[model samples]
Target: MSFNGNESSAISLAVATEMTSDYRTNNPNETKAHFFGKNKLMDILNQNGCVGIRAYYGIDADGNKQLVFVGADADEKDLYSGVILDMSAPCPSNCDNTSPLNG
Candidate 1:
């Protein structure tokens, strides 16, 4: 199996909302979402040999939830030496209240 950077990762709004709602119900104090800037995301995607990306669940020194992103190669291996990204603006601090996914 190989990646050509053509994977379908879409989900219906209803499903997304339900999942987020469940998460909030369980972890009411946790971050509702994480916002990674487009430029940083594009940088990871544009790295040489990067066919996709993988997000790892993380916790910062402050014990806040975060995500660590790294480029993935065609074989689904992490490009550890490439441009890894973090420092997302997490929700509760930066969120769109109007978005259904945030509720």
Candidate 2:
């Protein structure tokens, strides 16, 4: 299917909890989530020809997991030379402990 830049990715709370729970059960000691401000997300989306955003799994120098964001065109090509956003606040260090997704 071709990407028209719009995708519905919302999941029910129960599904989200289960997915996060599964990850925690297996990893035990990993970041549960990352926080990116709306401004940063909008900046990526505002890039020329940016129809969507793509995230890549990464590892920082400290061996902690990280996510790198970049703009993706409707053709599903990453705009590597365009704006990139990273350095997000990670869970454990910056998490909402009460959230089911973090539990």
Candidate 3:
């Protein structure tokens, strides 16, 4: 999908990847043992009016686990507010930290 400057979808994917990568690198064991399902990611996308979503796990240059979430909106002008959570801090059992639309 074509993303304008700082598109929400692109930004959310980037944030997810960065958070996962950091978590994996710092906690490799956790990455292999604990699997964060795509349900949360999909919820975020769906709540934001995304018609489609794609998620993946990978390692970053720093050997960190990366979780990427990509989504597409049919309406070009459609704007989404909140769709992601901040990974900078520890998330509760519910995985609720911060809003993805924030940054």
Candidate 4:
């Protein structure tokens, strides 16, 4: 689901209710997330300390083809944060990274 500027007021109220603060009051130019499709493969990777996924168009500082991230575990400190997004059409069935682990 998505909302435009027209629903800004309603979105503010809902965000305040759940997230405790709406971006309108503090920063009028606060960016909103564009999409929220569930990524099932995020589970297996997270057990290794990965943090999240951000699917925006742009480039890394090194100028690599940097879409579909798999990162977020910090340096030297071993933590299993988890993966957040895998932007494939469909991960293979044979892959052990299945759902229900975090469902």
Candidate 5:
């Protein structure tokens, strides 16, 4: 959980959050009722070589969790995005958008 630095993990998390937002935005009715995980994005994050960045456990959209990340490069500015991950349950590597997985 050592964010707030030029760590790749932090940046990757922020990117994943942004991607999730985009996914939801493009498909509202399909995504609003369910939360999802982007496996490839997560794979990138996991390769960041950092300890597990604790994922807050609870209903994904049950509350507000701010996702603020310091760029891995100092020249890059901070990234702020809102995300709602369904950490409440687990899904396989490829969670399809066709069927809303009730995780």
Candidate 6:
């Protein structure tokens, strides 16, 4: 589902946490080097604290706009090396990306 700036921010945090935990559990081999590879995404995640900073532009299965999840961390290296997650949900008929916070 489409999310406004604020809603997107909230969802980003949730998704980042989920992804981080998943990585720690499922991909223990992951290291700081792997997380901080993407500079831009890592910067945004650091400033926003677990917010899902979109890495690429694309659409979901239902044709709804989707954003890539940027993992959480402070150091650019740490941030990029973290796991990426997906936070797409089906949009309701009345969904409004302009004001997703209302949802």
What tens digits encode model 3's per-residue C-alpha lDDT throughout 40-89?
Answer: 65565666556554445655576755565555466543333545432322
What does candidate 4's lDDT look like per residue over 1-103, in tens digits?
Answer: 3222132234554444445234324543332222224445445334554433334354446553224433334342323244434333322222233322211
lDDT of 6 by residue, 59-102 (tens): 66866455566554323222455555444432333334454232
- Winner on TM-score (1 vs 5): 1
- How far is 70's C-alpha from truth in model 4 (Å)? 6.4
Candidate 6: residue 17 lDDT (0-100): 57
In model 4, which regions exceed 4 Å deviation?
A: 1-21, 34-36, 40-103
The sequence of per-residue lDDT tens digits that candidate 1 reaches over residues 40-82 is: 9999999989988899999999999899999999888899998
Arrange candidates by lDDT, descending: 1, 2, 3, 6, 5, 4
TM-score of model 5 (CA atoms)? 0.22
Lowest summed lDDT over 10 consecutive residues: which window, candidate 5? 65-74
Off by more than 4 A, model 5: 1-11, 32-103
Candidate 5 lDDT tens digits, 29-50: 4423323346633532443333
Among all windows of 10 consecutive residues in model 2, the one with the lowest summed lDDT is: 1-10
Superposed model 1: Cα runs more than 4 Å off: none
Q: Estimate each model's TM-score.
A: 0.93, 0.93, 0.31, 0.25, 0.22, 0.28
Best by lDDT: 1
lDDT of 2 by residue, 17-84 (tens): 99999999999988889999999999999998998888999999999899999998878889999889
lDDT for position 23 in model 6: 58
